[model samples]
Target: MSSSLASLALVQQKTGAAQLDRFGDPTIVGVALAYFAVIVGVSVWAARRTRTASDFFVAGHGIGLVALTVASVSTSVSGFAFIGGPGLLYSVGLGALFLILPAAVTNVLGAWVLAKRMRLLGEVRGLMTVPDAIGARYRSPMAQGLSGIAILVGIVGYMATNCLAMGYVLDAIFGVGVTWGIWIGMGVTLAYSVAGGILAGIYNDVFQGTLMAVASSAVFVYVLKLGGGMAGLSNAITPTDAGFLGPFGKMTPLAALSLFFVFGMGSLGQPQAVHKYYMLRDPKQLKWYPMLKTVGQLVVLLLYFGVGVGVKALVSAQRMAPLAKPDAATPSFLLQFTPALLAGIVFAGVAAATMGATNSFINIGAAVVTHDLPTALGRPLRNELRWGRISTLVLALLAGLIAQYSGALVAFLGVFGWGLFASTTVPALAIGLNWAGATRAGAIASIVTGLATTLTLETLAYLKLYAFPAGVSGTAVGLVLSLLVFFAGSWLTRARAAAAIDGDVRLVMDV
Candidate 1:
């Protein structure tokens, strides 16, 4: 039995080692190119239909439910599910559950708090972007502009993280320099985004999301086989290091739970995820959105669950050496153990998903810059569709530049981006829109507080200048403070009769 295990482990190690020599693998490159062509084709199809400002921004408010469900899953998951999530689990053990266990709950929560109301509001108000919703809710252009600015700041950081993650996969597949990969990845994403705007992004996401689902499920099955059974997998690890099986791994309980709170509550603020509301053709269809969306997300996320545990099990079985770092977990395992074709498929799927997700950010950031911010300052553009395209190109380039030059620092951007979005937007948009007591002053203050807390704490955490208590993260702390400030300001400054929320909005909230 021992000899058989040793032989199996040796075979796994040898296969894993082959990843380094796969640069010229035609099968991998061919699969990648095919996926790229599909994305471009989808974008072009969507771009043709995007003739007006309305069409460019929200797919003419006529997207199918299946597309919306998949796009939401795609935008919500991003490179984090494919690369970072698994890597964190492999390196940090159970602490990574803090990052993911909230996923299903949050999906349900977002759907409950946002889905129906957001769609109804968009139809009633002609809302296009998230800032539009916040602005409409508060009747303050300044509040809208500030929300736009906050979103753009976080979008830049979010784009930087995606570009960096994409670059790693591109480099591993093609033997190109990381810098080259970053430019190529950004350029491809910007091409479709600038040409088709949100219309392009949504369609691309539908395509990318489907591929990600299929690829991830396949890789997960392979992970199970490689790690033996779940029992075998567990036995391989628990005997040597029992901590790996702990509820919070090595992290403090507070930190683990903080992950839950931040992800669950903060998800309300993510524009890309919620912005899908603007494109839906039927508000009534959203009743079932949570179920379908969760299924898709869970499918893609299986890779995260499988690879994280599989790699740990392999290491414990003495079949594999420890990783150099956490982020390398996905790329390392894929290249080393999976068939070359499967590795390439996943590589392309992640790159596609990364670029597809980035396009949504670029689309919204452009909308804010060309429409929301300028309109708030009393200079709305007439040629909005044109400006949306131009702004997307410029913003994508800027994010790509930041991603390339910031090097390893881009990792910090992921944490900061997620935290900033949730902290800033949830109060003003999520709670404020639902609660009539929410005032302009309260909205602006919440946005500012969220912006300041997340930026200051995350930067300090990165610099090791301010270490959050073990279980409490910058995101959790920032969100709690922002909520407190928002509620306090709302209590102090009553809403005026002149600027009261729309009667219809109030009725919707009641139901």
Candidate 2:
């Protein structure tokens, strides 16, 4: 039995060695670490000016256009873009291209419609947080409390998902244990986030976003070259493996449409993402904002699809078989093909992407707890700045713990958090801002219905029971239902409270 065990070990070592040869070198770990240090140093420096709750939560409402643009893209596109995106293309083929359409639409719509109005209102009303905006809109503590809780829940899960991706990258690149990777990643994010808050997050995001853009562009060029040029790479794939050219590839039409709705409309509702709009120094600076944002997004998405397609074409299926997990693709690709220095840059980019998103969520979640909850509970809550920092540390720890236990799938883990936020908050917030007839009762009913319906649908889907149709996401359903209840409830309650309504709400209808 001992001899048999020895033989098995020998065989495994040989196979592992062979896999490493085909995949690439493993010493890029040092390069990756150095890049991370530089980013953290920048974040620390940026934190020096964060003196108040407003500064910590929204950079004192003074974010310039360039900083806001970079931070927006970085925070919105997480490790999922760096890692899981390529893996999806590797497995599903061309159909994944459809995912880009919704992003394009959201960017244009946000720039033209949402960004200017939100910034105007945020400045006018002194709205520092999403719940603050909601509470002020309808004069309802219940709306504020519920929205804060929803933000916390969604952000915690989102933060955990990014941490999980960071851990996977460390383990793949450095042969580190998953536990050590998670702890180190968690520690770094908590240190910077707790120290500087939104200032730190936005600063690091600018640096990290630049790194991700450069690295992804370089990787795309190099991988295509290595794959024997575009034509050569195209010729290398089997008919089925050429899914990048197809309409839906492995995803059904419904599933493809679902991705669009989830990623697109979902952006309008994300607390961290939308919060950036509120922080801009001047709404006038937003004239070029959409163009800048779209260019960055296009570059990132193109590189993601390029890398995934290139890897599927160049790398042998047998070698990539073990890396069927989406989160494994980026590291596996680097370790197998790229040189040590460039590979290190890619790894650092991955970590930056993860940390950027995590910091954004941590700061946003802290804001929810410190600003929204205390006000909702009607507590005096003095020393608001101190509590905000404390809340950041606590929330980061909770999210890190969740990361430790989460499985390795990026999209699956992240979609729940994204879906929850979208269903519960997006409709109410969006409609409240646009419609004057929106009442407290309607907003409350909408929030409750959105939350309850999303949760129930998610639970049922998990149980393999009847689920919402494919193309129509839970978020879509929640948004539609929430809108219905919001309007209907407002209509039913309008006559009784018509005279008593506040000036801001009544201003539009009276006009």
Candidate 3:
């Protein structure tokens, strides 16, 4: 069976290069247009439901568990799972295991530590954004404002990352210039996001997530069928490259594990992931959240592993040439193996979802700028929704432009955004929400410490001034420092005797 499978895979690889030549197939273009029409329809429906600020921010806190689960999982998948993940695996083999570890674990950990506490706070405080929860938790305008600033910084970087990815995707599929592709992505996303805000993100996520799940599954099946089977593929690669099958692949063990700390522990600080917590309609439904989230994440991630291994196997067997660039691995796979119709739908859907994800980042950043900052300063805007829409458009446009001119700046910001969020919010928001002794001073200090550490380290590394140790990522360092500062600051501030959490909040926490 293995011998036959290997032969079959070799035959497929020989033919795969010919498949890549179908650059602008009409079938693919047609599918993309049809899928886009569906997205526009969903955007209109969501826009109708999004007349109020609360509706724009949290879908009026009416999103059901199933929808929230799929959407949350979908949002987390982002560009990394579909586009970058396979490339990552191709370059470093089992180095992606560190990422996969957190991918599986964070959901359960988040459900236990964050889901209930955040959801409860949202219900009790009528929270609209993550910074709103931070403000209410710490009862400090300074902490709220500082967190808002941190969110804004992260948003620029996060949005830039998405824009760059979209640019590449559009360039490949439509043969357009990368800059034009980014502008196109920004225009489409801004239309619905400005119209519907989080409602657009939520409904679009559900729609996009369902499409991604189906397409990802079909692609995975194709990968397996083309490769014959995973075991056969493994055997083919094992002889020539033993390390490729090892647990750490080519990465230093320390570097591999650094991905874990950054992604696993740092995930709590991710405003985007935790953003969905506020929209769950029922608190008890959270009991099922981790399972649904994990299952959905794993299902979508099959493409990440399948294509990486399948392509590696084919290359080792001399049936395929080695990839020209790691980033091209995914596009190469789709062009070669998947049916033209399916490839069109999957690629277009993934690109649309990328825009939708960017919409979310812009929406949250706008909320922080317009609603949370003013509210913290005790001067709430009467026209918050209007200003927020304006901010979202501006932020998206700014990010798209920045992505085109300053790829390095985007990389610097994007690299630390996760850690910055994790370090700043994890202790102050995630842990603090559960720990009553968590003082406002501590939250404030931690946010400052995290922001400072991440910016300094990432910038220095980018400048080639004393690189981070091979296994040590800037994110892990920042996160550790932030936690330490939070504890030390809290201990000192506890001397003043902080106010107890509100009776209502306490009551909800106990529930």
Candidate 4:
């Protein structure tokens, strides 16, 4: 019996080794090269149009509704949806769905709360960055500067997450070591971002978003076949791990609900998606954004749900071994189960998500460094265009280092960044724009509170020094505290609201 067990172990080891050997197929390598060449072509085309700081930052406010919608979807989805998302689903079971469940309504909420006002404000007052909108709303450079600081922090964390994902996908596709994959991935993304700016990012997003939609939909069909549909998936997983299909899966109820709440409300504060509203040529098109974005997100998110359950079901049925790590779910499924060509497309889709998001963050980080921070400090640069490009390089380098050293999983890093942005920006930027009674003091207070609480709690948790009880997230705590402070501070400074908000800002909000 002992010898039989040894033989089984040997077989499993060989299976794992065989799976590793499948990484760099010629078909996949060819597809990846072809896709990248197309991306370079798009970047070159966009570079010609990106002559000014305004063009670099916001595509010169000339993007059409469809392009803007797709770009927004691509940025919002990112590597988290394609790679980290499935990993989370594999790790947490049903609980992972909480992270994206709010997509159904968040886009509509964003449209009603911020999109029209943001675009109108940009057109009226020439607003360029997310903090610029905050500064205009509250009439405070200090508020803008603090907001910029928080955005910069979140951007680095978020960029590192995407860069890490790019490392994984590139490694799987090219058979490069993860370290080389990271460096190569950053180089490719940085080249286009530095050359074409947001214009390149936007058009590339249009292409990438389309590819993701097609690949995700097609791959989901394969997932269904492998999992034998919902019934087979349940039969396989339930007998071995019944809890995985429960409402909250392995997570405590509180944790699942917290995820839902944070991700739901947090969408309002994500600059990568919200900032694109400024690029829409016509504010009248804002009415369609919610529906269009919701449909697009739902369609593209198929791979997020499909790959995870498919991998889990296969493992439960003893068809595949348990994954070495949750993040391996997507790549493993692609390589082991799908056709080589389909795997290549999905692999490219992963790169598309990571590179697109990295581009957005670098652009925002650049604007923060070159335009927002300097202006808030009353030292605005004369050549923001040149400085913005340089700042992108610097920010990319810093984030790449973080990606290299951080031991956290891609999904967790993405969550931290999301939480940071939600806590810091939601009350100050999203709420402040819609509420007439929000004072500059309140905005500053919320930003300070959010930034302080999130950074402190996340840092402590990361160091293993402390953790919240099950179901309680540090992000939720920070966001709740920030909201409380925002209201309290505004109440205390209620008389200053009229003085804080400009007449034009009031008109735009009212409209």
* lDDT, candidates in the order shown: 0.84, 0.75, 0.80, 0.90
Residues 300-369, candidate 4: write the lDDT tens digits: 9999999888888887776777788788788878877888999999899779878999999999999999
lDDT of 1 at 451: 93
Ranking by lDDT: 4, 1, 3, 2
TM-score of each: 0.94, 0.89, 0.92, 0.98
Which ranges of candidate 1 are over 4 A from the true structure? 1-17, 409-411, 495-499
Worst 10 residues of 2 by lDDT: 315-324
In model 3, where is the ten-residue run with the lowest total lDDT?
407-416
> Lowest-scoring 10 consecutive residues by lDDT in candidate 4?
4-13
Write one digit per residue (lDDT tens) for candidate 1, span 1-511.
6996767667657755576677758888899999889888988887788789888888889998999999888887787677777877886677887777777888888888887788888888888989988888877899999999999999988988888878877887887867888889998998888778888888888888998999999999998888877888899999878898799887788988887788888888999888888888988887788899888988999988888999889877767667766766777788778888998899998998889889889888988998899979999998998988889888988888888886443335676788889899999998986788888888899999999998898878777798777848898898999999998988888847225777776766666
Q: All predictions: root-mean-square deviation over Cα?
A: 3.1, 4.3, 4.1, 1.4
Model 2 score (lDDT): 0.75
Q: TM-score for candidate 4, please give it.
A: 0.98
